[model samples]
Target chain A: MHAPADPAPLPGDRRHPGWIAWALLAPMVFWLAAFVVVPAAILLVYSFCERDEVGGVVFRFTLENYQRVFDPVYLRIFARSIGYAALTTAICVVVGYPVAYTIARASEVWRHRLLLLVMVPFWTSFLIRTYAWITILKQEGLLNGFLQAMHAGGGPFNLLYTPAAVVIGLVYAYLPFMILPIYGSAEKLDNSLIEAAYDLGAGPVRAFSAVIVPLTMPGIAAGTLLVFVPAIGMFAITDLMGGAKVPMIGNVIQNQFLQARNWPFGAALGVVFMLMFVVTYGLLQRRGARLAG
Target chain B: MIEIRGVTKRFGSFTAVDNLSLSVRAGEFLTLLGPSGCGKTTLLRLLAGFEMPDEGVILLDGQDVSHLPPYRRSVNQVFQSYALFPHLSVRDNVGFGLRMQNVPAPEAAARVAEALEMVSLREQADRLPHQLSGGQRQRVALARAIVCRPKVLLLDEPLSALDAKLRHNMQLELKHLQRRLGLTFVFVTHDQEEALTMSDRIAIIHRGRIEQLGAAGEIYHRPRTPFAADFIGQANLLQVAVVGRNGTTARVRVGGGLELTVASAELPAGARTALVSIRPEKICISKQRLDTENLFEATIEEEIFQGATDQLRLVTTQGTRLHALVANESAMQEAFHEGDRVYCGLHLDDLVIVQAE
Candidate 1:
């Protein structure tokens, strides 16, 4: 008796959006403007200012702090920080990938339990956890005592207060972050694609490099950035574990603000760090987009 | 050429593929057609060396390939999702297999170009897979699979993701490509229409067994099992009584006292049980109500106009229902009106008698 009803439930074609979309997006715009955009603007302004006698930032215009950031003392420190972060990131990828892949391909019941295990360590405060590491790795700490109980010849290996200890701590802290995103990407990887690669005359190594690695690149990129960027600016680990022996860029910047009493120099360093983030993020985004396209 | 001998795959306790045996002649176009969960895809993977059968042997060109790893086999598969490298342009994706084989650079480029031309995608070689439409991506996948020219090509529902019109075009294009290249194809799909339209031979699978394997016409017209008859086409399966038999032919008494003969190898000697099947189009409908030897009176319960043809569901005088399909039904008017009296005839040769149980 009546004509058939229209099947399409959505009102407008996606090509043309309506006012409701803009309304829904308002809150996101407000959040980004309040936190991210405003902070970046303040940092930019502080970068161009001069420091007063008491380390309070003065509004007087000056490019002196920016010029001083290029000094050899600071540049060498910056390079060392980058080198350490890069090494930590590389280690995390090599160590985290197999664990993540195993967890992803596991049975359903075990997968949830395994994911919980990965997340459990994060419930405790990160600083407290770092302190716990100091207790374990320090001289006459659990590791050294245990080594001595085993009748080890060397009195105690100076395992703590070294660059290696800093890396170990960083790798331990950020490993789960590296694992989770790569796990997501690897879990969604279609199994047939791997079979196709193998069917087309690719050896196991070739299939992994050509198909699996490329397919899961987004996760690898995400994990790399997650570990590397944070490791670069981690002043706490350097102070606690590196025994304040190594002067990383992060330590230098922190000293400028609180110890050295040079707020403008610290502001300049913060701005440079933020700019480095932008460059690294832009390059990674382009690479991911190229792969997806 | 590929041969699967008594291959069986079991997942824990449940069997995915029963002990199945079939062969693919060189340059033959074969399809494994079935419903979902019917194990056709499992069989394809076995042939591709992705899964090792629990008990069986696979031979390619008279050599035992059962123990060979997937990479060592001279075969390639076009995955249902296309599996185009998201990181690579179309040219690189298509050229991947050739590169793996260590072919010379110029030869690989030439072969990739030839393969791309075959799919009419040479112009889009520089574009990524996502940059192309779904149909174009499908052709790109086909080009990638064919570039290696392996001994066998396995396709797992390759065109199923495309829209209706594009699917039709791709079906024809795939058949043409298969013939031109003379490559053995082992396609898997649940679409019976696609199987009938494109395949030189169809292995109708059900559950974990191959119910029947023959040419398309043979499988459609001379269905060996009730499942095959119901799956391949619309059949008016009416309960009937086998009144008599003579050599290869048998006379069956259907509902409403209609009698028909069918050529079948086996039929129990009894008038109590049998199912006589006839294609909907095999029934002749008339409005004038003439008396014929093979006649049945009915009333039209529903009539549906299907553009080119009208389908009528009728109830007989004895309250038994039957469906009839009329081609170009616009001009053939009258008794197709709802509740109008009609008489129909069933072609004797078209009648197929299957076991009732």
Candidate 2:
């Protein structure tokens, strides 16, 4: 079928109306400047200034705050945060891929219903949901009691306030983020391609790896960015589930502002964290571009 | 070689393929020709093992593979959409089957190159499917399926996606490819001319049943059923009553007392009347009186100027309407105008009776 040609420009409209475009974009530009850009600019300035003893930002410039951010202890936390985020991302992919694929390929009525189920969790407050995890993972909580009742394990097992619990919380929170993007890609996949794969003598697994997975890589990459970037900087889950025993970069950054009363140091850590997200996003985008090319 | 016996496929309540039996001779290009939803595609899917027949067995080279999955069967399909892997390079897509079969890497590479060369797409080997044109992607799909060297290749309207000019070229190319490879081809299409051009045998399907199956010429000239007669080519169906029968030819009366001679072979024994098919091109319209057994005095009612031929709509003196396709020669084009009196002649050999419905 022939694509409709673009409509010809109206008479006397050879030049773009620059003022209308600017007027339409004004609100978004104002919002970004007021909230994101101005706050980021303030943080950048604060990162080079000192904090007074009275828990107020001092205008005196100093390199000490940024130097503290590079210390071995904070660096270790940064590495650990990356490790946790990577693990969370891997688990999200493994768990979310099949669910997303199933939902995507489901019959139309069921596909919408299943997607609604994935999003149903979002109607509740996120903090309330994180606390709900506490009720399930505590020593005498629903999980340990169920395990005990089933005779699958011997004791309450110190399940809460652990790294495993923290990971479980992180995965639960971000799994839908992984599922939605992957679903977007998988839903657009042509059924004939899968049939062609089978006709070409590739079994189900072979077809999945050779055709389906690569075709859906863009979604997986998008989901990874959605899950991984936020997971690395997430402080609440680690605090509520890890019981603040181990500090991720997010927890340290949070403690600097709230408990340590070190605004300059917190701003420095925030700057570094934002830079890492930029780098991670850039690498993922480049990988996606390479795959497309 | 392929043999299908009493296969039936149903999608819920809708029967896509009725109990159908067909056989393809070794290396023959057999086309399942039908309009959409006539079960031609379903039958092709049944052969490819994409859809299992609920009621029958399929034999591929004498082995029963009715319930086997597509990957287990030694068959490949060139999809109508040319379902080449968008993420894979042309070389990779072509080599995918070999890789799954666990052929040696070197042999797989060599075969992929050979298949690409067969389609004259060696230059596009490293490019993704999206990088190529529609025709190039179709070639890649062909290469991919052929590299496996399956006993049978199923093509689901592969050329339907191309423009008319390119489709004609690919029809010849596909015919040559099937010949060179010596593989049995089970093709499906709604296009009548495509089926006639490429198939060694054509199975005219209607509502999941084979109405008629024969070589292209036999199907065109002697369609057993009215559906087949009308589907393949333009045929003027005349309702006639048999008045008398000689040993070989029968005299049949058309509307308002026009008698025509038809071969007795077309009439069932003791049948009083029959529906007969006459190709439009078979009717001769001339200014001079014609010396034929079945001749009628007619008036040219309308003339349609087709590029190669001018179609003359004629009304006999007895008020029977018929269409005659005459060559578009300069003299003929000007000779047959609306309201001109002419003699319309039909040959006995051109009139064949076909089954109703």
Candidate 3:
């Protein structure tokens, strides 16, 4: 056995033994090891196991669950879910950017009031808010009733239980996520830089595109990640507003556990879903770094 | 040439710039010198079209540009922070204004290269603003503003951020650049030394009005107002009562009943109560009473050695405090100590009669 040379300690670490530091970190370490690491290890192990006939774990190793996760039916559902999430991110950006910019540029009094308004939706339960949207958007809801009352020449249109309704719900739920981050970036932007641009002969449109957009890009990237990742895995809005008519990846993964009682397949799907997130996030980080450089 | 007439800019109840008027001659380096919140920066912003004057007309080459936006005006400003785009390279930052004018790529590139060469930053053109040192960034800002060849350039204390030594060097370089380009330069700064070194004419502003506007020597030696006298350089403002007037000069009695002669053309007509402004350097000190037009005996209260000169605080026999600066030359090797009796002499040409206000 060989003893390694002791490196110099940090500035304030000389008085305390190394074990004291570990003892101080024990609670956080235990919580992560118990909740996160242990669950991930279990999921990885179950992903390769087989299920018994009575919907219990057989404890036998197999690759069949992983193979079933790549079937055409489930792959299409994953693609549809990604497409919807991308569209929701785009819509949120388009609608939230101007609102965030306005709030950031407003006077201090108005800025705080407007920020409070943006966060008011978070005070209530998200499920209750989605249910409220249902009443306003359904076929016989307030919109259709108002249209019928005006004696319009068309029948009540099917507004809910569609892709448009799903997108609307996702955008509404995730808009504040977009606004808050972008506002943070916009608020810290130096006004003198804009004035410098105009003084250098750039018009208003040119200044906004050249100076403003590139400066606020970090916030846009952060907001996109905040809205896109969870939206792909969302099941509540699809079930309520989308009527669950079209199968999404979330709907299928949720059904595998509850209705089919296929725990191994569900574990496999979850592992694959987590892997997709890792890859997507890795790509976005690379792109963000490149843009910054 | 730029001319501002009756410019009054008010922000709500506070008037930042009062009814002020100034004419910047062609190719002249005029500095707006004042302390903070004296509306010197507001006047610069007005010329840059960042702020519209409440009542005034700004004429560039005899054409009204008061209502024109900053982009539309043929003027550029070098902000105090440099305001260089952090994401862009030095070359791109310098070439931004030309690109805005729809200049062709090759021409804009050549102009950018020339401007960079002028500032001696050709090698670091590919680096961003953050990568450059403070002085290098300031030069880039200068290059950026001058590359467009605007009729006028407004600089709002652009050299205040640098260290003292670098600021002195940049001041010389900026003066050389301004003279070579022959563009009207309107600079704003509270530093009197910088104003005296770089400006052809200095406009001392105070409380939203121009107290005095003239060449550096005139403003320093003969300030018409007390504010200008105190703001420009160190001055001993002695309260005096006018005894009589004598053809462009006035005889005034100091607090100690001593009479002195000073130039009085700037003083208000028939003014009895007046103030006499005298430069500290003008008063000479000696061990014996020297033969001079105005002589006074005082006790040296304190002596501050400042390498090249010694600032002596003297209290006259009548209890009037006065400051006299003596050169630390070899001929005057005998140093004056505190509480020593000394004779201070003031020349006739060194004093100016100013308004009591």
Q: For candidate 1, lDDT tens digit of each residue in A1-293?
A: 01121232333455655789888999998999999899878778888998888878889899999999999989999999999999999999999999898888898899999999999998999889999999899887899999999999986888899989999988998899899999999999887778778888899999999999988999999998898898889898889888889978889989998898888788899899888887998999999987776
Best by TM-score: 2
Interface RMSD of each: 9.5, 6.8, 13.7
Each prediction's TM-score versus the true structure: 0.90, 0.95, 0.94
As for candidate 3, its clashing pairs are none
**Residue lDDT tens for model 1, B89-131:** 9899999999888999999999999998888777778987767
User: In model 2, what lDDT does residue B250 have?
Assistant: 89
Query: Which rank order by DockQ, best down to worst?
Result: 2, 1, 3
Model 2 regions more than 4 Å off: A1-19, A151-153, B330-334
Those runs of model 1 whose alpha carbons end farther than 4 Å from true positions after fitting are: A1-59, A150-155, B246-249, B255-257, B268-272, B287-293, B329-335
- lDDT string for model 2 (B190-227, tens) is 99999999999999999999999999999998888889
Better of 2 and 3 by lDDT: 2
* Chain B TM-score of predicted candidate 2 relative to the true chain B: 0.97
